[model samples]
Target: MTTHHPTQTTTVQTIFRFLLGGALILAGTSHLTWARTEFLAQVPQWVPLNGDLVVVLSGIVEILLGLSLIFLARQRVLVGWVVATFFVLVFPGNIAQYLNHTDAFGLNSDLARGIRLLFQPVLVAWALWSTGAWAAWRRNK
Candidate 1:
């Protein structure tokens, strides 16, 4: 919890927040379009719902979350938590992909899949930091 000048914090967070929003929008769009197969690779076999359905639903959720992240600054902290929870909720798919050695999104080998495993936390942290959700939690705690 290193502190920065409020101006710096606000500026940096704004940039990251926008970037994350745009990324989510793109990802969500892809889920319903050309990258549908790529996203399907991340859906674990254990899920009772059809993998395509899961991808579609998750994509819609991503779009909504991304839109909220960009447009709802007043509720950014709560949106951030929801976004982080989304990442957490989907992490099992990532793990299953790695364990099952499924290739998609150019992750062709164990090394690549393993590396991707590391980024999930980064996304969770990004959702938190870019929206001050972590700080809010800290304050409440």
Candidate 2:
């Protein structure tokens, strides 16, 4: 059996995960405070709930996702799924921002928002790797 050396990858992954998690937490916290209006403006008109409530709920979810990313190791698969699901769920918000000509995460231009959208898949990949799904993929292939 070949032993997998997760040392380097783990170090890099831990650093990335920590940063990503911290960023999300900060973003989520703002939804509860300073940036609430900005987040509300981005909410699609089609969503059934009150915009403020939605923002708060989304903030809660993001906080949970961030916490899970930082604290949940053995349940990495679950964490990965949460991150992936969050990405999918928030995609429409991104599209809405693009359609309404609004800035994303305080970005200045449509081009910046468009560029940031490209990272969703990369984040999904990172979530998967954080869960060791990449290792499984390599081993299976």
Candidate 3:
């Protein structure tokens, strides 16, 4: 008897997933090193943790998430959900930067910061779409 297996993803999805993974890796590295100060500017001042400490910890988390995105295809759906959640969680920091008028990463003006805010949802969608998480969830439902 012969058996057929189901395909999990399309070529385009795989390409986008890898691209997202690579981007995440680069962003995470910057968070830890060269862009550390810029990342601090995004932290909400009211956050109890020291800004530097928060940046360092979040950088570590980003690195791990990037690695998971790249090497954990079998678990991509789970990773996607986690990554999307992370993006949502950090959104308040982005808002705080805009509301507080903090300048960092060249987002000096309100227009620049406002434009940046629009990309967060895109990133969340990218995580779900690239990993087929959205499709998988719908399929289960």
What value of lDDT does candidate 2 attain over all alpha carbons? 0.77
Q: How would you encode candidate 2's per-residue C-alpha lDDT over 79-134 as one tens digit per residue?
A: 76678778788888877877787864676688877886788788778776766656
Q: What tens digits encode model 1's per-residue C-alpha lDDT throughout 102-122?
A: 999999999999999999999
- Reference-based lDDT, each prediction: 0.92, 0.77, 0.90
Model 2 stretches with alpha carbons more than 4 Å out: 4-9, 137-141
Tens digits of per-residue lDDT for model 3 on 1-141? 943222277779888888888888888899999999999999998999999999999888888898998899989999999999999999999999999999999999999999999999999999999988988887778
Q: Which scores better on TM-score, 2 or 3?
A: 3
Model 1, stretches more than 4 Å misplaced? 1-9
TM-score for predicted model 1 compared with the true structure: 0.93
Q: Model 1 — which ten-residue stretch has the worst lDDT?
A: 2-11
CA displacement after TM-score superposition, residue 19 of candidate 3 (Å): 1.0
lDDT of 1 at 70: 93
The most accurate candidate by lDDT is: 1
Candidate 2, residue 133: the lDDT equals 55
- Candidate 3's TM-score reads 0.94
The best-first sequence of candidates by lDDT reads: 1, 3, 2
